[model samples]
Target: MSSAFGATEKSTRQVSTLRRFLRYVRPYRKQVPIALLCVLIGAASQAVGPFFIGWSIDNLIAQGNLQGLLLALLALTTIYVLGIQAIREQIVRVGWIVQHVLAQLRQDIFTKVQSLPLSYFDRSEAGDLMSRLLNDVSTVNQAFGQTIAQMLGNLFSLIGIIIAMLSINLQLGLVSNFVVPLMILTTALFSRWARSRFRVTRKTIGELSTKLEEDIGSVREAQAFNRVQLNIDEFDQLNAANRDANIEAVAITAAFLPSIDFLNTLATAGVLAYGGYLAVSGQATVGVVTAFLIYVQQFFRPIQILSQFYTQAQSALAGLERIFSLLDEPSQLNDAPNAIEMPPIQGEVKFQNVAFGYTPNQRVLNQVNLLAKPGQTIALVGATGAGKSTIINLILRFYDVTEGAVLIDGIDVRSVTQASLRRQIGIVLQDTVLFSGTVAENIAFGRPDATHAEIESAAQIANVHELITTLPKGYSTYLGERGAMLSQGQRQLISIARAVLIQPRILILDEATSSIDTRTEALVQDAIARLLQNRTSFVIAHRLSTVTQADQVLVVQGGQIVEHGTHQELLDQQGIYANLYALQLGSTTPVNTAP
Candidate 1:
């Protein structure tokens, strides 16, 4: 009883996924019935063509009537021509529909990926997620682009052939089709086995794609460390696993397909033997026997194709399962039903006894409280893994607080729409990210409607105006692959210019100058200083220069604020902040605190 219940549940899930998939095709509903009609008409023509042969042989040939034979030939040709056209129409129409459905699915998947929480990406591989977007969706495309139309045509043809056979001679047909039950049983058993195997293949292929993307992205590191051989061996394991999965799928097909052919051969022998017996005993005619032979061969062909379609459907369904799984991933951070758009910011930011953790068992920030009135810069200085970044994440509402609240201008951050909140905040990270576009466009990323003159003004404010003018195309110059053409300082300038153009009320510079040389750091610092003016700002950095003049400095340790004061006041106390300041300035003071 338990097994039966499990099977029923499994069947229900498969149906659910299929129904979900069909919704993508529902927009093209009008075209679908037309395609199916073409399939039906094609099958009818294919099924009827055989009867003419039997009629011609019986009435025309046996009676030596040349005119009737010629007319039968003409009729048969016309029937087949119609079948050919209908089949072609169905293929073209369905292919168009499949491409469009796959396109929509991919667009929706990408949109979902963007809305997913940072925590989801924290635990998942970029490569694996990309595989669902490209590889898995492509699998569904390959399967359904050709399979659906052809599968329907084969099914209709099979049904028509069975009817024609039974109407011709019920007893002979019944005897000949004795292997039909065995064919179904064989197809069913093999398809059931193949479904799980193909599912494994889908996963293994995705894993392989993940490894490929990771290795390719880090090829420079591998070569720098002389670990190319190590990477090769690791990649080989994933590659071998993918190969074996596919080989098993091919092996199943090899074994299963031949069994269909073997059954068809057996059925043919039975039909020829019994039909001959009936003809000799005057229970059937010579032409009837001839047509039975033709129909018998034609019958197994559709069965074989349908069996092949079933196996392919298993693979397509597996791909669909993966795609749907991605689509079904919850956006753990969504707006409240009562959420309202955030008003224009005065940027009096506050973290009120906030507590948060990526997981429930581990808290990264505990009872963290802070306030920054509009237009003050707060520097968060801490050791690595010391909850400094978690506070910043809360400010951006990247993750909702596990407890307490974050507010902007006394309004709860979660109570406002995320888009509205984020638009008013600007971020520049240690590694500057720029898309492949003009220097002007990178700066105007947050404000796509910004005029070219406005872009130049922002660049001038960030002290990058001269650099842009020096580039071959000035502001129109293309920045390729995260602005690879630019130096580290240049990238930061572009990033700062982006922040400047937005004029965000709250600005975050997260180690924004960490990677540059002293000279470049100075330029980035100068740009950051200008960008930070007249905003409630948060700065997290490993360097002291960015923090030395902060209006307020908070020393974080063990997920709690150990000290908070102005830079000189913290230095005067000689506490955790003093020790960090001493270490970075090349002194030998040490401090320890409770975890």
Candidate 2:
């Protein structure tokens, strides 16, 4: 959780972050000028109202100029009504523009997330990314919709009042502004503190969201292990931290507004005392003194509003910092500058002296070499984390090799666009993933434009067409998240159907049948045999029975291929493969050592 905050350290590109944010406002360029005009009109109108009131007090009330007073009152009422309407119009237009800007921002963030490398996801939590997408983006929206307009409007109002005050009486105007410096000082100090606290609050909220998502997704596991109370205690601790951070932020805000109010009170008193002295000395009229008092109040009101906007502005900037930080992360995998689109492949894959590690100085695959001629089955058998999956990752170019190259038809995978390289390969993992959609849609995922006949054909080839017919809506039936509504075997069959639809030149089955029952395995095996008929295939299996017919079996251990031969040939060698095969069959006979 602390690491999450550490990751959001104030970026050096803060100015660029703001510049990019302003670019979002560019689309609303025409509307913005009109909106700001409305704001200006509203501020000027409000500033003139106090003059009309003072004129009526001095002329109509004191000198009994009834007609003049009625004219002044009418003018004040009209100005007040127009000002309200102008501000309302500004709000409506700004709201529309703000909504569009937020929509565009969210779309950009989502697209960037898609382009990021797999390693980024391996190190990031889904909840944290989602928080940025939802919560942080919404905060930025507030900056545009509420904070920006308020800041601008109040700024115009502040300027208008200052000018009106100075025009009426120079002495009182100068006195009224005595508190301006004090207010600025107060705001500067509090805002600095508030910004730091609000950043922590936002980061804490993200961490809490991440924890909640993780715990809820694994609730069943927690219950099975009887760790429910422990989970609750942990959540309570995070909740308390979030609450404390928020309270501290509130405390800073709580101190800020009142300090402004207190200064405002002192300034108002100064205006009254000075203006009364002027009225007594005949240096200023009663009406002018009264109007100056009203103008003073008007002056501080915007300052007060501006102070509050400052807090919201800080929060929005914090969110912007986080969002831009994410956008700044360069993808670990990228094609070379001169890379070309991979031509349609014949599926001859070779790993020549390949080596890799997720981190420096820690190799996961070491000096590995292997070859799969066109339309051949290469079986990789090893214990978990013995580099079986790493080989598949290299074949798909998910990660670049630390040394040497992976080639398809003698062209380095790194020299081809990833999309083009991956388009020719199909993969089915041990855990099949199906999105929330109709059975037909899942099968057609790799080819959305695939016709009904093509979809059914793929399903029939995977041996799941009969199962689809049994569903209430056949191919149109809705499968819930990850296809939870279907049996595991049914889901695996659908995944295979998806791969079959792609008609990929190279196919990878990583422990594809390890979790199914013997009956389902037999059915899947038959489908796989048909699917592998003419495609280059890589089969990784814990169940050696699945790899018995492979054209070549590579026994991998500790990031190296210890043996490579036909299944019968490896059994004759009586090495690791022979021992592993015997153990799976519940045989205890000691096999002869290859050494």
* Model 1 residue pairs with clashes: none
- Model 1 poorest ten-residue lDDT run: 586-595
Total backbone collisions, model 1: 0
Residue-wise lDDT of candidate 1 within 99-136, one digit each (tens)?
99989999999998998889999999888889889888
Q: What is the lDDT of residue 500 in candidate 2?
A: 94
Top-TM-score candidate index: 1
By TM-score, how accurate is candidate 2? 0.96
RMSD of 1: 1.8
Task: Report the Cα lDDT for candidate 2.
Answer: 0.88
lDDT of 2 by residue, 397-482 (tens): 88999998998999999999998988889998998999999999999998999999999999999999999999999999999788
